[model samples]
Target chain A: EDKVVQSPLSLVVHEGDTVTLNCSYEVTNFRSLLWYKQEKKAPTFLFMLTSSGIEKKSGRLSSILDKKELSSILNITATQTGDSAIYLCALFMEYGNKLVFGAGTILRVKS
Target chain B: NAGVTQTPKFRVLKTGQSMTLLCAQDMNHEYMYWYRQDPGMGLRLIHYSVGEGTTAKGEVPDGYNVSRLKKQNFLLGLESAAPSQTSVYFCASRRLRITNTGELFFGEGSRLTVL
Candidate 1:
């Protein structure tokens, strides 16, 4: 079974705090790892990691993939109230070009 | 520029009732997918289409059917609604040949309630 697992299903952080979210996948044809931030209605794209040891950064959010361990991590620095959202991790498979998703990490940032 | 659009932003149906949700993408992409988001389960794939006439089941497809008669439109049909089927349905589109950083674009989502 191809699946992805995210750690710390829910997390709480104070303003200016930094946190880390973890994702591990066991897929047959892993092509890329994608991160998305879902707020009220739709999920917004965050980052897509394909190469090991390479990091992708956007503002205060950064992510990196470790192909050897079949794991990935998302780091958020300077958390704010607006950063409270569900963070999703998914694996993109080469075959069928489909994505297998994790349950997601719920993040709550307090002011 | 309408990236991806889903019709009927919200709907309510009784058990055994049938309904259809429509999804359209103007980006001319080759892939479209239907997903359901529940409270604990993030997003589960219901069905997907690779092209205009090709459709396939995903992780969970027992209660749904889909068709892609046109390149820009994908329709999801619920032959018989069940209480467990109540969820927020999302429509997404992606390029056929994806790059390392290429990500999916999602619709605003349609909230469905089954009684």
Candidate 2:
């Protein structure tokens, strides 16, 4: 079965702290990896990583995929309370283009 | 652009009642999908459509039905609502030719409650 696992299901950090969330997956015919941030409603798209060693960044958030290791990491720098939310990582398969998501990492950034 | 839209943001249904959730996307995307999110659990795929008149089951398709009569619309139906079926449903769409870059745009979820 295709599976995605996220470490440290929940985390708490003070404002301005740097945090790293991890996501590992094992699936056949992997196409790409995507990260999303969910606050209260639907999840918003963050980044999509396909090639290994290439980092995708958006402001304070960045992510990279290591296909060989079958894992990815999302890093947030100088985090704020606004960054506190559930971060989700998903692996997209080639055949059906289906997404298998990890039980997201709930980040709590306190001021 | 309206991006993606879901009808009836919230609903409550009796154990045996039936209802349908509608999803529409204005991005003119060729691929559309339906998913359910439960507490503590990650989103799970229910059904998807590659284009108009085509539909396929995903990881969790049981107790649900879907229809894609048009390219911009996808609908999810529950014939008999059960407590287990209560979840937040999301609709997503993506471009067809961008296979390697699997970026999906999602709609505001519809929260369903079954009693």
Candidate 3:
């Protein structure tokens, strides 16, 4: 079965803290990995990583995939209260146009 | 542009009842998918359509049926709603051109509760 696991299901951190969320997956025909932030109703795209060791970044957020290890990490620098939300990692498989997602990491940044 | 829209944002149903959730995308995407979000399950793909008139089952597709008769719309139907079916349903669409990175645009989700 294709599976994805995320570490530290939930977390609480003070502002200015740097946080790292991890995701490991086991899926066939894995094409790329995507990170999303779910605040309320919908999850917004953050980054997409396709190559190993190649980091995808946007402002304070960044992610890199390690295909050799079958894992990926999302890093947030200088976390703020507004960063409190669920971070989701998903693998987009080559077939069926499907995306298998991990359980997600719920982060809470306190001011 | 309304990227992806799901109707009946919230609904409550009794066991044995039936419901259909509608998803429409105006991005002209060829790929549309249905997913259910549970407490610890993240998002499980229930069904997907690669194009108009083509539908396929996904990770967790057992009690759900889907239709993609139109290129811009996909419908997920629950034949017999059960407590196990209570979940937040999300619809996503993505444009796949060559070896794309798969950036999916999602809807605001439909919250369903089965009593």
**Candidate with best lDDT:** 3
TM-score of each: 0.97, 0.97, 0.97
Each candidate's clash count: 0, 0, 0
Cα lDDT tens digits for candidate 3, B1-115:
8899999999999999999999999999999999999987899999999899999989889989999999999999999999999999999998869978788999999999999
Superposition TM-score, candidate 3 onto the true structure: 0.97
**Model 3 per-residue lDDT tens digits across residues A37-101:** 99988999998888899998889998999988989999999999999999999988887678889
Worst 10 residues of 3 chain A by lDDT: A25-34
Tens digit per residue, CA lDDT, model 2, B7-92: 98999999999999999999999999999998778899999999999999999999999999999999999999999999999999
In model 1, residue pairs whose N, Cα or C atoms come closer than 3 Å (at least 3 residues apart or on different chains), thus clashing, are none
What DockQ do the predictions score, one after another? 0.69, 0.80, 0.88
Query: Quick one: RMSD of model 2?
Result: 1.1
Give per-model CA RMSD: 1.2, 1.1, 1.0
Candidate 2 vs candidate 3: the lDDT winner is: 3
Off by over 4 Å in 2: B98-100
Query: Candidate 3 — which residues are off by over 4 angstroms?
Result: none
Docking class of 2: high
Better of 1 and 2 by DockQ: 2
| Tens-place lDDT digits, model 1, residues A23-53 | 9988747778999999997899999998899
True-structure lDDT of candidate 2: 0.92
